[model samples]
Target: MLRACAAAFIVAAGAGAALAQSQPPITMAINQSPWLNSFVAMVDEYEKETGNKVELDVTPFGGLLEKIRNSVRGAQGAYDIVNVNSLWLSEIYSGGFLAPLGDVQAGYGLPEGVLTYGDTTNWDAEAGTFAGGGALMGVPVNGNVQVLYYNTDIYAKLGLQPPKTWDELLANAQAIQNEGEAYGFVPRAARDSIVYNFTPYLFSHDAAFFRIAGSGKADVVVNSPEALKALETYVKLATESGPPGPGNIAQGELIQLLATGKGAQAIAVIAAWGQLEDPNASRVVGKIDAALLPAGPAGTVASSAGHWVAGIPRNVPPEKQKAALAFLDWFAAKERQVDYVRAGGVPVRGDITGADLGDDAAFRFIGAYSQNAQHAVMGLPFAQAAEASDAMALSLNRAVIGEMTPAQALNQAAADLAGVLERNGFAVTKLPDL
Candidate 1:
């Protein structure tokens, strides 16, 4: 009996030694965002619990793609783990930079349906798959979708109800302008951040930058009638109801405009909910609430998902890869995610399934936000997402600034997309007559 106990102790010690010896310090590449301070806040605790060192490099959103591009192209081992935006998954996975999550399934526990934004049948598609391909690439770490935020007092004073359609939204904007209160609406329109905000508008009009996946052949569809109409609506609204020079405004600036009451309403990202409701950070606190984005001519209110995900780089050593996956699993767990949200991080999980949000102003829209996430489209899932986005931005900016009409701008964008697709060896099945 004494010998048996001694044998068990030896086996346990051996396992511990194996773990300590194999895993190296993890280096994670993340986007620079204030909300992610929650991750930084918990690093010490994570290291203490795991007995592993972690190094975090937060790159600016504009520069992150280039930084990640260099890492993948060089296989430089610069990052063992990377926090990637949804649009970058296609390029990153195709570059062979990410290790399949399924390969490391034993390293983490997969959450059930109740904890994921989508159900079991679709969670894998939404959270795991890269570019609609059947490979699990990463675990979601953030929730970002567009929602409508309006100043309740302003709406009441203007006798405006929350907009339920784009026409109504336009009318509301017109009302604010005619009444001489403030900018009617605000949203990011700068080149660097335009695509993220523009996608919801594109979807609302049933226009897509590319038919990136599915049967037959993929194609660029940016010059369709729907796309032209959407572009016209966006440019007109910005010129008439939004602040002058919207082409220079981005997410942060738009948020400031709304929070300070310079804007009466906004179609903005969900990450700013905490700031919008905080009395210390906003002048409109207790006077603002969020609603689903207004529907388009098609009677659909589609949005694009902009969440960040944690993935392991394929260039890392096996042990370090294991450690990276372990970190992702721990960091994205239900308890940690909830704590992160409470600490100003964006909520990504559906774990609040049965928990009561109960009129807490900070949490009132979470359930609605989650529902929006399910219907959200992920943009232009192609190996050249960045390149395609740059092309679209140039044309979109021209239209917004009145340097070109919407039709001219969209025609140029469609041509650019066609060139990109053909250069990447994909056949363009269809294109607008332009």
Candidate 2:
């Protein structure tokens, strides 16, 4: 009887050891969107490969930010991973709520070039480093570029080719409006959409919200003549052919109008085209195509590139930190990046350009856009960027709705931006030469 009891105890101990080898379940929080679904699918594949279970917590964008801020402040570390925009890096890093990933990147054999973009040793190092150089804070998950999406059918009907410059775009807009079948162009003129859709124009004109005269210093430049010109053009386009209250339209409504063939073109994120192509979600599946945004007086076109950034929160257990890095290394691998592209997550790897994918029209369009992304511009850095962006958006909406002249709106926006920077303790300086 004693021998039999000992045998049972030994077996139970072995079972417990096996269970311990399995990864503890982890939960990730995300803003509710179609992208979240794609991420969940990738996590499911990761779970199967590593014997780990991951739970996803979906919340509205606004709510997600508040919850994350609260969780980090309380040192709760409720989430194992979080998705952050580049602009929020400063605020979050300043709070010492994120763990550095430099060692983790080294462990994973991440290439020098990949790290360079996010490395402090390179240009804009101050922007990439957190809290005065503690650790690498985040891994870029996906690439998003703003592009000009058009309905192929609509273009064919009007005998229109892609606009190569701002003048051409204006001409096309007028022609499309004259046809009286659909609006010529649509952009997010209202809410935050205007800021997101319009910044590329500013950059294309060699204008910036803040000009970096030195390595780590940037001066506000929103009131420059070039910026004023860009703003005026944006307002002109919306007033001439866009729908009523273009400044008030939601992104969803704007997209819906474009997808239903009520609009001819939109300056939109490339990922949005995927949403437009999903037969289950879009009615314009076969008719849409995209290209880079048109050039301006600066003789260059600009697109905005945004990526999903993953980072470890500070105060996580060391072992868990190791695990998180392991996961990120595996997730950011080139093979996995390709898989992510196949699975509808945009690829950020340099080697995995859109052209390298299959030769379908969708891939062709995405590839062209991705190739041009190397020159795309990023918005103002995260510190107080959101507030500044909101002010810009508000001013843009006023212009779009004819509530203010372009000059009046832009001047006010520049003043408002200056106030935001000042309130945040950043010094205000002259606008850039442009």
Candidate 3:
């Protein structure tokens, strides 16, 4: 009897070990953003339902990139999943640092729209494939776009409607400046924030960093006349209509200026405006409204589409990779996407627009911005894109300080940008036809 009892105990221990092995937890690393908190909550709900554990290693957004790069290079598999900006997907996917998600999506029985491969308009086709890399690397976490946020009170006080064209924007700026008590406009012109604000102008004029060659490579086209014109126009606005020393104005100060009613208008990301609507977070509660960026010479308003993407790392085992993909599939379901939107996260799914949320004015504006984002450009390959931003910031600074002509500043920037492209292994090509 004693021998039989001991044998039964050993068998039970073996069974417990096997069960544990079958349900190992999946680990993920995410940048600290509001969306991440929602993801955590979702993960908890999923774990309760499925008995699958999730471990998250959260880090500041600034440090997350380096950590991901180093881990991928070292094959350390520190994270099974990571969130990255859509712009970096090309580099990471082409370099084989990310696992192919197509098969994983299929194996998990993910629903349509939950696993988007190409552009939303042409998902089955390869329209959004990154430079013909031939694989869908990641799933978009959020859909973001740039918009013009104005002080409605200021506009009413000055008898001005939102500008429809660049010229009109300039004229309105002048009108605001003539008031003398309030600054005309405030945009990010400093190194850290200028890129986000300046890219929209580049788009509004239909200029891009590179022109796509038929052979899936990109040729540099940053020095085009349209680009120069856009840069020159930006210089004029920063110097003539914006706050004094516009280039020296940091992002925090810019936001504060707008929130405290010191500034008339700002070109900002839609998400930033949502943050300002939060009662605990904003000083400006009912004073703001969003509109499309002014039209440029191209006769249309173009904006930059910024998206955050999530994907499984290649270093993980196939089984674990499959599990991570499963979690992502669930996280991107339309219901969950609505939850993300309610939490101030942008929605990538077409079915959930800001207008569907309710009668809130902010949500309605955000919906309009989302529609514009669908037509915006993507896939620019700026080597050290961050540094290129700094160069633009410097040119604006010079113009604001009255130290250089707009033409001179832009010309110098063109030359510097050519060097940046060449260093990144791109051939210096002719500027785009403006």
Q: What is candidate 3's CA lDDT for residue 353?
A: 63
**TM-score for model 1?**
0.81
Native-to-model Cα distance after best TM-score fit, residue 141 in candidate 1, in Å = 1.8
Worst 10 residues of 2 by lDDT: 1-10
Q: Which is superior by lDDT, 1 or 3?
A: 1
Question: Taking the tens digit of each residue's C-alpha lDDT, what string does model 1 give over 1-434?
Answer: 00001010001122223344335788888887876566665554455555667788878899888888777567457888787777776667666677777776553345542223222112223322233335666777777777888888889998899888888999999999888888988857898888777887888888888774443257678888898888888887788899989999988899999889999888787877878887898988888888788778978777767777777777778878888776666665565555555556676676553253335567666765766776677666666777888877888888888898989988888888788877877767556555
Cα error, residue 248 of model 2, in Å, equals 2.0
Q: Candidate 3 vs. truth: CA RMSD?
A: 8.8
RMSD, every candidate, angstroms: 7.7, 8.1, 8.8
Residue range 1-434, candidate 2, lDDT tens digits: 00001010001122212323456665565667656555556665666556665666778877877767776666568776776655565567666677767653453334322422233211224543222243557666666677788888878998999888887888888889899888898867877678877887788888877765544445777778888888877887888978887888767877888878798888877667787887877778878887767888968777765555677776566656666666665666665665666666676665666545666655656554564465566566545667888877787788888888877777777778778877876666755332
Which lDDT tens digits does candidate 3 get at residues 40-86?
A: 65565556545677787778888888878877766568777887775
Off by over 4 Å in 3: 1-24, 106-134, 212-218, 360-362, 391-393, 431-434
**In model 3, how many backbone clashes occur?**
0
**TM accuracy, model 2:** 0.82
TM-score of each: 0.81, 0.82, 0.81
lDDT at 266, model 1: 83
